[model samples]
Target: MFPTIGDLISYIFHVNAKVNLQTFGSCMALAFAGAYVVFVAEFKRKENDGTISIVKVKTASKTMEVIVNACIGFLIGYKVVAILLALWQGQDPVALLFSLRGNWIAGGGLAFVWGIWAYSTHKAMASQFIHPYQLMPYIVFMVAVWGFIGAKLFDAVEHFQELLYNPVTVLFSRSGFTYYGGLIFGALTYLYIGYRHKIKLIHMADIGSPGMMLAYGIGRIGCQLSGDGDWGIVNRHIKPGWIPQWAWAYTYPHNAINAGVFKQGYYELPAGVYPTPLYEAVLCILLFLGMWMVRKRLRVPGAMFFLYLVLNGVERYYIEILRVTPKYTLFQLSQAQMIALLFMAGGVAGFVWLTGRSYFSSTKQIP
Candidate 1:
């Protein structure tokens, strides 16, 4: 299991670049980038078909631009000049970069320049038409921030003991995130943002659902690559002749979590566990493709999103059977399974409601 880019590169090319980049974080970056592309294209397609209504959003107003851009400029100018000064003085630039050392004049000048440029840009675009997709960047940024917070908070709940032992470590750790928490929190944030922008809830959900599927698929690939302990219970079943053995089960040697028994300067599971992350990655990617293909055909407002929930719930519920998670003794089900069932039930009800609504409305319109 390769935890970092440096590790993977060393194994393949036998060279030490010593890159500190994390595999999971890099994959998440790619996931967001891919999602952004999907949003851009999906919104444009909806706009062209007259399905999306353009609203006058005040996000790019002169005051907003000036304030945000000035802060950005100040930070950039502060650290950059400090680093340059340190290098000239034969001191450690990296150390200075993190310190309070900075050139105030340079920072102030850049801040003014940045603010003026942003204000001018907004003023120039005042008369031109704006697309509804202009809100995508802000939506994505908010979702990413709050989603991470939610993921961490839920993880802390599940591992309360660990958090108590080392509060800072557990809270800030890059791993140990719960996906469902992020989904719930991010969805709430997305809804609020959509409301602020006057976007229809159903339309927003439909546009984002497929991209989210793709992002999740890509993220699971990271979990598998890093072996961050999201694997399944031990697999006793023999591998079929047609399938790759590692895909069926893996010992997860040198995992990012450094789990399993250590022996002879190595760490690995005594026996193989089912590679559930890989399974999820494959399933979600395929499902994303299917969703993308079927999206245009779904005439009902929220049908596409409801379909997403059903598909997501079904896949996760079945996979939870193989996964290693704490279970509720009463129901003999993991928390994820319970949530999955809710998603599936909600999806079915939503589909029924929306279909009935459209049918009744159309019937009433018929003279």
Candidate 2:
């Protein structure tokens, strides 16, 4: 598994590169891109159905534009200047970027110039209002940001002992995000945004269903690629002759997190474990396709969304059986499994209520 693009590029070039283009990050970027495309399609469909109004962009005041541009410029300039300086100094670029080691003078100067350029360009361009659907990218971005924060927070809670011992490392580490945490926080954010924009909550949820599934599938690919401790327990079962070895079991060597116990002679783990992440990726992708196909035919606005919850819950719950997570022995389930049960129940109840309501309403009009 290639943890970073740098590793791949180094293999191809036969030269070591310091750059770390993390596989998980790359997959996440792709996930967001994919989600945005689906969001745009769904948004258009809603607009065509007269469920939402077209969004208009009004010209911003000169001061407002300058302030916004300046803020953007400052952030860009800070990171870019820091990275370039690190390269010049032969320092670890990633470390420098994450640390408070930027050249403030250079960053400020670049920011001033960039802000001026942006402001002038805006003034010269014709201002026009765009469709609200066009803001899907921004909405997706915000969801990602908040979702990550929530995921991290939940992870910290799960491993409270570890957090207490090394708070900084636990909080700042790139790994250890909980999927359910991300979903809950991300949903709340989406709800607020939809309400603020006057978009129907149920309709927005339906629109996001496919995208969310696709994103989860794509993200799981990263877990497989990086082997960041998301694998299953040791699988000692012999593989059938017809079955591929990788599918049945895997010994993830040189994983990004450097997980697993070393064997007698090898630097990598000797025992093979179930590749749960790969299984999840394949399953979720199939589920996503199924949902996409039936989205339009679902008819009821909230039906698709509820169905998604049910599918997601079932998939995760079953997958948890093969996963090697800490279990709540009293309940004979994992924390994720408990959450999955809740999601499934909620989905079932909501689907029944909505479908029944629709049925009765149609019958009333049948007079």
Candidate 3:
């Protein structure tokens, strides 16, 4: 496994080309990009089928647009200018960009330029109409932000003692994510935003299901590729006749976390662990395909979403058994396991109730 894109490139081309691109981060980004495409497709289909209608909204003032762009520019300029300077000096990026040091002058200049450009683009427009799919980019951005925040918050809770010892380090570190936390928070954020857009809860839920599942599946590929410690318990079992050993168990060489003792430049686990992330990626992608295939057939408003929940819940619950997660004494279940059960229960209840109603009746009524 390659920890970073730099490492991957080094291996592939036999060069010491140093790039700052992180494997997990890159894949996480890819996950969102792929999901965005899926979402666009799903939304277009719904629009074509007349399941949803176009939305009309007032545009913001040119001044407001400039302010927003300027703010974004300032942040980007701050980091990017510093990064470029570091590259010029051949300094350690981890030490440079990760620190508070930045060129404020560059940031201010960039912000000014960005604001002017935005002002130029923003002519007087009272309102505009758009398909709900146009909002998916912003929706994806919100999910990434809130999902990351939620994951960090949950991780903090899980390691309260450690957090107390080093609050800044634990809070700011790029690793230590809890997918369930992200899922819950992201779902809430999506629903809330969709509601604000006047999209029906049922339709919102239905539209988000396939894309969300696909994103998770793709994101898990990052976990597998980077070996970010989402693996299962040690596997020392004898090899099966038909199964490949690498598939059954992996030592996770060149792992990102540097968990095991380092004999050489790179890290490697002493023993093999079940590649749970790979398993999840495989299962979820398959599930996503199956769900996507039958989504049209499930005419019930929330039926597709409920099916996603049930299948995802069940998969996580079983995978938790094989995983090495922190468990609560209550029923000896992990936090994720408890959440999984809740999801399963809620999914079943919601699925049955929604499916009982006639989709035709719901379709005729606007949200």
Candidate 4:
């Protein structure tokens, strides 16, 4: 029912603060960062003092730490800026930041951050006891499960009856959560655990690469199945009769069948809409294939991950054209559109420099 990004925020949370599923997910990311910091500090100390001296922070560990810290710093910086923006409008930034004072749900948000950070750091210190890469899969799996539950719970809060009829469905329900919620949180969880255990991210990324794409593809399937409102439009004007009626047509269970109908009538997606997420999954698999083939082609750190960003950005940008999400326009382009452009720019820059370095080196005469 809510058409625009602005409306979705207001309608869902009744807040003009510009928060949504993404923001909640970011909160989880921060928790991951906090956890990593704790893990790194503790694990490193234990390794140095331990009798067996079995612990070693490998290159992968360092890279993971560095990248995660940078991400966390960015999040904190953004939050500070948001605070300043609020203050300029005479809003109490501090109050807003810690508004979890009375709300259990908001408290959970805060607690999610604290809990993950604490638990992860504690585990990281003893990570030497386990194989780094061996643990990453489980962590990511946990992230997938928790992230889904978190997003679904948030959605159910917005749609109270959906929870009332089948409370258990809140945990199993598909299609109601946001993708970014899972990505941001899931990535953070993996990063924290990987860095803590000093997993070789470069190689590990290659190893786990397919799973990333596969997981996303599977998640999108959930979205399509539940029709939790991630449908694309059926551009009646552009496609005319070319578009099938079923392409954008969807029927929700009538009131008698489900808890309650949040939005009346079947959702009529915008015409000519592409199933971008599904398309993205396919692209990810292809990109993963490319990365896997050349896992050993480059010696540089973070090469595969950098490539992933580029691929992801490209996929997202192309899909934005067909997406109907709300946006803040800049030069007539949506926020996601601009971010994708930035990702492409960064990826291209990195790729060029890396390849150039490699190309010159390969041609150099060796004694």
Best by TM-score: 3
**Which digits, one per residue and each the tens of the lDDT, describe model 3 over residues 255-362?**
989987687788888988899999999999999999989988998688898898899999999999988888887899988889889889989999667655657567
Ranking by lDDT: 3, 1, 2, 4
Clashing pairs in 3: none
Superposed on all Cα atoms, the candidates' RMSDs to the truth, in angstroms, are 4.6, 3.3, 3.5, 15.2
Candidates ranked by TM-score: 3, 2, 1, 4
lDDT of model 4 at position 339? 64
Candidate lDDT scores, in order, read 0.85, 0.81, 0.86, 0.50
Better of 3 and 4 by TM-score: 3
lDDT of 2 by residue, 1-367 (tens): 6677666677779888765657777787888888888888988987887877765445777777787777767776778777766655555465664566666776688778877876777754446656768877668868988998899998887788899999999888757899888988998898788887667899889988999999999999988887778888888998999978878888887787777665553234568889999999999999999998987788778888899889999999999998988787678898789999998998999989997898999999985
| Span of 10 residues, lowest total lDDT, candidate 3 | 89-98
